[model samples]
Target: MEQESFRERRQAQAMGIDLPLGNSPADIRRRMEAIEFLLERSIQIPGTKYAIGLDAVIGLLPVVGDLIAAAMGSFIIWEAKRLGLPRWKLWRMVGNIALDTTLGAVPLAGDAFDLLFRSNSRNLRIVKRHLDKHHPETQIIEG
Candidate 1:
């Protein structure tokens, strides 16, 4: 089972406690996949056929939408730290959030931006690729 909560996994890593399948690539893939669900929207979503996701609906909450979504992006950043992603790549992940938040803050445009940008999900994929290259649990520090 893939837990989409980046905050929870980041905590587990910081504690040096790897839950079962928590550090596996499959788990990373699954977590990253959640971003997809969050970015989904209604009205057949332009390019996509279906229309549904936490992001579009959540944005309707007003005031809390972007903040909550941005916080979710932070989890990906935190996970990158624990998983030992390279600084360059890590920044790229951070940039995703920066861009996402900026556009998501707009009025009507922000909603459109959130639907298209999907920063949290995109950042997760970036980190996910790094995890696949080097299994998080098997990482060994080499000074």
Candidate 2:
């Protein structure tokens, strides 16, 4: 059975089909967590309870900053696409990034927006929902 499965996977790969192998739910979750940390809350504000990440720090660089942050945010979208999320869901994720970038371009306001928006985290949630609904094996059931 294993040999047949391996043979079929190889055939699929040879045919240019991207198959999800060994990408268990745990792996996806860990990826999401890392992305969230990078884009959302990797640093804590001194003498304050608020947290921030690279996304906000990068967004502080004027025009180029928001662009860089948007580019980083696209990573989550790319992962969602790899997971075979529906078009609408993908669009929604794009919208989140778009909104984050658009509003994040507004100098002071944009930096604040980046601090609060956390588009990567939102995209991660969308990916998780899609995985739970479409890929049962990737779902992490809680007691």
Candidate 3:
């Protein structure tokens, strides 16, 4: 399946090596596009124009909100680690989330920072590109 293979390509890219992966730049593009929808509001989800976004949905939890958000954001670092990203860079990535989580505790101000920072989505993209480069064998499989 393409979904499983996506990780493969991502892994390949992170290593700075070439693999037998085929092309489906669309998948990559789609992911980036999805981040927009995921990280922010885009015309709203129809019935919920004023619906809570990652920033708002996440903000409502107060202290718990930032903790959960930061934890979820840590997935990027986890993914990077899976792709064997350099330790220094990986640490820096974690630091980004830490910073975001810390600063995102200012109530309304923190939510604003979440929207502006969007570090989780940004880091995911960065790691994906890095992984894709080394392991281009992201052949979409169908069953």
Give lDDT per model, in order. 0.65, 0.80, 0.62
Superposition error at 129 for model 1 (Å): 2.7
Model 3, 38-68: lDDT tens digits are 4444335567544334644675578798887
Instruction: Give me the runs in candidate 3 sitting further than 4 Å from their true place.
Output: 1-56, 139-143
Collision count of model 3: 15
Q: Is candidate 1 or candidate 2 better by lDDT?
A: 2
Provide the global lDDT of candidate 3 against the true structure.
Answer: 0.62
TM-score of predicted model 3? 0.59
What is the descending lDDT order? Answer: 2, 1, 3
Regions of candidate 1 where Cα sits further than 4 Å from its true position: 1-21, 35-48, 136-143
TM-scores of the candidates are 0.62, 0.76, 0.59
Please tell me which predicted candidate would have the highest lDDT against the true structure.
Answer: 2
- For model 1, the local distance difference test gives 0.65
10 residues in a row with least lDDT, candidate 1: 34-43
Per-residue lDDT tens digits for candidate 2, residues 64-121, read 9889888888877877777778899999999998999889989898887788888888
